[model samples]
Target: MSLARFLIVLWVCLVSAALPLNAQQQTEQNQPMQLMDGPMDNMLPIEGQRFRIDADIEEITLLFFREPNSQPLILIKPDGSKWYDSDYPLERVTWYTDPNFDMIKIVDPEPGPWQVAGRVDKQNKAIIVSEVRFEAEPLPKQLFQNERLKVEGTLYNGTTPVSTARFRETVVLDVLFVSSNNPDFDNFGADPTRVAEFSDNGQGHDEQAGDGVFTGRFALDVVPGEYLPTYQLETPLYERSFEDEAVVVEHQPVTIDFQLAEERGADNGIEVSLDEKLVNPSSVAINGSVSYPNGEERRFSVTKIDSFPHVIPLDNLAYGKHLVELTVFATSNQGREFELQFNNLSFISVEPVAEPTAEELAQQARQEAVRKAELERQQREAEEQQLIVNLIIVAAVNVVLIAGAISFVWWRRRSKRLNNDPATAQKNAEKAEQKAQKKAQKKAAKSE
Candidate 1:
């Protein structure tokens, strides 16, 4: 057979041998391994139920169901020891929950008999995911305000991407336009008409429906401002939203990377790398410095390096919030010398730059109080429901016990009366007289 045919035959044989084993394993894993099969209304600690872990496991996850959350999982080892996460040398287990989902992971579990203390739901509804990313290919960092703007995103589940299978049906992107010139800090005032609908239905530039990539684009004409993109996947299984903080829009689109690092036992300094694509390399004049709190502006050497990234270091900066701004002067191809200013580029060293104002702190406290009150209310309601169910069960058990006791007493009295009655005495007397005659006859025979 040819090489291709031989490989195909080998694959088929391997699959045929593994099919039953794979199916059985999957079925076992999917089933809810409960400690006991009964109503989990009382929230009582159940013992005596054991489950065996016969196979190697990389992770064991418990996903909770129903809103307001339910019981916490308690695990016990085969040697009658409580299993705590801290005991494991390398534990990747996590417990996280949201409004839509709750999940916990136990990493590298030992193989043996173990017991679960809490009841698990039948349906977990945790979404399957492999990876997700937002991308920008050949799009320039700097674009004119009147040009077209495009952005792309892709969502994945394991190796396969969920494109048109979800797309507008679940995955969505909402673009927020913020005016940088006179920005509104309270309400972002994003334009509803600028919302872009992305699709991967093999239309236009899309390669395939299930290829996982989604694209959206529109003209950048709503004044010169910063545009932030947010992506949302609202599904029954999982619901989450992510904002892309790396990309933004402005007339002089500039991106900066700042880090405070100390070298050779010296004080920390801010290292910055700047990139701008709109102007000619040799013609561009860029000047910037790190402004300190004590009215000190330390400058760094700027170069016209075009091929590789040029890093500039500003040293001996003290610990505090600092602002660094760049003023770019460039001659366009049309011989126009235009100067652009990027301001409020702030960074803090050792401490946060934007500390909460007094009023803001008060507002935060109020919100936290309200949130705690609501959580307590929900917990109380859950406890109330559980108590009611437990009370009903207890009442039923008491009734059964009382009925059993009454039946036992009545049966005891009836048994006594049946055994000691008038007919019983007469039968016993006749048996005794017969026994005496038999004994006398036996005695006479022995004498003869």
Candidate 2:
């Protein structure tokens, strides 16, 4: 009962772990990409609109949206070259225009200020510049038909995992399988050579979703051959696609012992053995050889062993890397034959160790010193620039303060002159009397 309870608990933990993966996958599939928010960097470049972009971004994706009948988006390169949607070299500059939005994809663009000019009406722009790296883990490359296969993937935006809310909306995952022997297997677009599609969903032989893992099984009844597995993971900030091949073959039921090692100078040998139950000892033979780097080939005599662990003598090898190969042919008592070749096993010869010379050590020290000096120079230059900026700010503030003080003094003197001038005071009194007399005469005329 305790063992059964333990198994039940283990099963429950597995289910619980899988539930979140499924939930996350659903969320990714269902949630609409909130393309307009979260990201603070957006630009609407109009005609003669100049903007500077960071030089570090290796790729730039420009997204433009506007109401219908707005000025068509136009951009001019820094090299005095003009670019509109439909620019040549579909790779460097890609233009996608529809009723929804106008977009462009630029790869390895020159780092500098790029100009934007064109029709501008209620225009919205989004600029996403990032470098993405993808790591794809595929199912076992050697599997028989009907065996379940799994492919897992981890996505990164720049150096960080792509879990940021900023990219969740735009990220998408696609996995495809193609046959390796197709005549036009090199080009998938032209021939549509894909044979199957895998999903992260647990159904259809897949394990779970949203856990950065995708899995799918091939048909049990499918033909045995080499198949290509491909996956594409893309987002607004990042995109990567990879394809590789896997093999399927008939299962073999036999055991072979293979070993290689050197003990001291001449005690080194290669050993291989076939199971007596599956292979008849009289018919089993091993052909082994060693090739050195200098075009010398050393072939061993045919070795036969009815029992396990047959040894082949390997001698007269100089100090270096050597390639060793083994080929085994075994026949059953009933005349069924099996051929197996194991090639390119590298064996390294021992060599005497030597200490670095004093001159070499001195050279290494100089190089390290030069590197440290360069770093110090950069730090000093940065410090000097910061100091210059601070000094300029201080000088500007002083100029402003001095000008303000001079203006205040001038105003105070002007007020004193006006208050102390007797002629000015008399002139003011006479103007008041003249204005009063004119008003009184006008009033009497109106009364009459």
Candidate 3:
């Protein structure tokens, strides 16, 4: 091959080899990013209101020739703005055109459309335009209500009105019954059951004309007392969910009015009963012929039950004061419930009859004494058994010591007889003479 042709072919081959290596390097770079997995993969600035825009034109070749006369006025500016001054190419075939925007830019975008087009290596591509607009309105204020409250107001996007936005309205009633200090209700020697619950029985909502006003009314079940009503507004965006100051309602009917402001907080309607003052009598007895307004008058015989707060019909007492006494006797198995007639009988105290003696005090004392003596006898016997066990242990130890002394004396006499034997004396003398000779040899070796 010719030198120039061979050099060109070698360069082409080198470029081709590098392309695959470059592509492999790119794949390795993307692998680390792929290992990261989680919801972070689909993150956006305004996640709740975000939408994806996908427009792609696949690979195609495109070519353009430079014009000699036009000189490509790359730095031309159509308006006075710096963003429009073109100091770079419109776009490169192999690269992306990034349009990074700042917060202020998004808040007030430049007026006009941005026309964008792209081409592959040598082919012409279609063009598109994107018009940018900004929405700078502040969020509307939240709304709330309490039990039996009138909600009337209009919602606005800004100074401009937003009449078409869909809105949801809900009326919730929370009736709380508070108790007083009575044994039946509270934990500290008080009653927790003394409670009263007021309900919001009436509620209505209406949409007004022209002004975009919304209003609501609630009819509260007001008892003959005072109460506290709280208000709250709960919406998705607002965390505080606006709350209103406590509104007090007296014995008479109440009317409240307020204008809806965009920044105003909603009052959470918390229907709390006021701590009530009850007139408690010093003493009340359950002793009467129980008669309901409609049901039968339950009659009690001598055997009738006599439990505290023994609830029976009190003849459906009117809105006034009446006295009734019930008579119950421990002996008379048949108890009697009487509706005392105020006009006929005089009130009298019924003292209980003294119980007759069944056994003498002296007899009870003797019985107790017998039980005491029996307990003492059992304790003494247990102690004596323990003492006997200790005595037995002591006798066993003494016998062991005496047997050991006799064995020691016999061993001493036996040892003395062996030493007195003539044969034993001869053997001992021979051993002593041999030991002396060995000791003398060791001493002589030390001197040498």
Q: Give the alpha-carbon lDDT of every model.
A: 0.54, 0.59, 0.32
In candidate 1, stretches whose alpha carbon ends up further than 4 angstroms from where it belongs are 1-139, 158-168, 179-195, 204-207, 236-239, 245-448
Which tens-of-lDDT digit does each residue in 193-274 have in candidate 1? 3545456667765666656667656445444445544555543334555554423344543345566643332444333333
Better of 2 and 3 by lDDT: 2
* True-structure lDDT of candidate 3: 0.32
Against the true structure, whose TM-score is highest?
Answer: 2
How does candidate 2 fare on TM-score? 0.29
Report the error of model 2 at residue 298, Å. 68
| Cα lDDT of model 2 by residue, 115-223, tens digit | 6665433344444534555566645544433233344555554454544322333446665555566443332233223334444545665565445444443332244
| Pick by TM-score: 1 or 2, better one | 2
Per-model TM-score versus the true fold: 0.26, 0.29, 0.26
Q: CA lDDT of 396 in candidate 3?
A: 99
